[model samples]
Target chain A: AQSVTQLDSHVSVSEGTPVLLRCNYSSSYSPSLFWYVQHPNKGLQLLLKYTSAATLVKGINGFEAEFKKSETSFHLTKPSAHMSDAAEYFCVVRTNTLTSGTYKYIFGTGTRLKVLA
Target chain B: EPEVTQTPSHQVTQMGQEVILRCVPISNHLYFYWYRQILGQKVEFLVSFYNNEISEKSEIFDDQFSVERPDGSNFTLKIRSTKLEDSAMYFCASSGGRGRPDNEQFFGPGTRLTVL
Candidate 1:
């Protein structure tokens, strides 16, 4: 079975400060990792994805995440936080069932980010 | 930019009633999916549709749930009997090209289903 765990339920940071949201995963094989953000009453937007091509993946809104296989972690980071960056973040792991040949996405509990002005 | 669209932003229904959630995937996308999130819970995948059939489904997607592509642009999820536990935010998503690991999935705003 595959699963993802988000270390923090909530994180608060001051504007212009660096932000970090930790995520770890457990999978039997190599997996694809992704970071998604959701604003209040908005859809989940893709921030970045790791497909084994690059250890460090850059995404929209100046967000990026590094996939560290040794640590079993794919943590999201932003150099500076903006007021609009406040939202719920989710870590997702994609895996496939051998028999079905179908993809399954496992999501983490999520981390709510608060940007203080 | 093209994106997925779901109908009925919110739906409230009595227990045991039937509810249909509709989605219009991106015109050029070939793979469509349905996901749900209970209040304060992680988002869970329900099912995936491609080539006019269900390519995959999670354990949560039981016999009570069914999906259909009645038209070229519309994908629908029907719950045979709604339960109180079924209340959640349902999201529709789609991806272009084959349903591969690298294809990015774009999500819709989501439909809030409330079963009273």
Candidate 2:
């Protein structure tokens, strides 16, 4: 079974400081990993994805994540935390069905980031 | 920028009542999906639609749940009977991105369903 774990339930950082949200995944095969951000009362927005391509993936709003196969991790990070960056972040892995050859998304519990001034 | 959109920001219904949620995916996208998140829970996949039919569905998408494209633009999910446990925030998403459908899925704002 493929699953994702977001290690931190909540993380706080001062504005202009570095932001780090940790995530780990378990899969039998090479898996596709993604990070999504959800603002309060808003939809989930795609931040970035890794599909056996570049290990260091860059996403919108200066967000980026590095896929580490050895660590089984795809942690999200930003050089500077912005007040508007405060939101819930989810780590997701694609789950493939061998019988149907189709797939569904398996999401993590999510990490809530709070940026303070 | 093209994006997915869903209607009925919120719906309140009694148990056993039927409800329909609507979404309009980005124009030209070929794949559609439905997911729901109960308050304080991880988002769970319900079903995926492609080529005018269901390509994949989770265990939660039982016989009571159904999806349809209806026309060229709208994709809808209908729950035959509602349960208190069914109360959740339902989101609609679309992909088929530029190449890999699994690459990225643009999600709609979501409809908050309340079952009484």
Candidate 3:
């Protein structure tokens, strides 16, 4: 089984300040983790993914996440928050098994980011 | 870049009425999926289709729910009889290639279904 837990339900940050949104996961096998952002009335956009290649993954809009194996965490961070960064973010876990021949994504409840100017 | 497109951006139907949501995934993609997000809830996976057949489905995808490719370009999801609880935002997504670990799924804007 695979599951993701976004530690924070809501996060508030001032524009120009650093941002941090924590996520943890539980998977029986090697996991493919992803961070996705959804703007209001928009589709889910992939920010970045960790597929065992790099521990520190950089994504669009100056966002990045570090995959920590020992802690089972993949937390998203940005050097500075922008007003446009306000949106709902989801932490997702994809099962890496090959026998399924299908991709199954397990998503977290989500964290709503509020950027203040 | 190409992206998934969904039709009937918003649909309002009475309870027990049938609803069909349409989607046009990326032209070259092979794996297609359906997911739903109820108001203030986590996004839940419904089903996945490939080769004109269902490859996997979640428990939430009950007998009342069905999916069909119908034609070469469009994928459709049908709810035989919707309940008030069925009102939610339904999103269609597609991923290309051999379903590799790096194959990221592209999503549609989603269709808001309001069951009255």
Winner on TM-score between 2 and 3 is 3
What's the chain B TM-score of candidate 2? Answer: 0.96
Instruction: Quote the lDDT for B114 in model 2.
Output: 99
TM-scores for the candidates:
0.95, 0.95, 0.97
Candidate 2, residue A108: lDDT:
99
Residue A19 lDDT, candidate 2, scale 0-100: 97
Error of 3 at A101 (Å): 1.0
Name the best candidate (by lDDT). 3
Chain A only TM-scores, each candidate in turn? 0.97, 0.97, 0.97
Expressed as tens digits, the lDDT of each residue in A65-88 for candidate 1 is: 999999999999999999999999
Tens digits of per-residue lDDT for model 3, B11-81: 99999999999999999888899999999999999998888899889899999999999898899999999
Candidate 3 regions exceeding 4 Å error are: B98-102
What is the Å distance of residue B13 in model 1 from its true position?
1.2
Structure candidate 3, residue pairs in collision: none
Lowest lDDT sum, 10 consecutive residues, model 2 chain A, at A95-104
TM-score, model 1 to reference = 0.95
Candidate 1 structure quality by residue, lDDT tens digits, B66-113: 999998989999999999999999999887676452477889999999
By DockQ, rank the candidates, best first: 3, 2, 1
What clash pairs does model 2 have?
none
The local distance difference test score of each candidate is 0.91, 0.93, 0.93
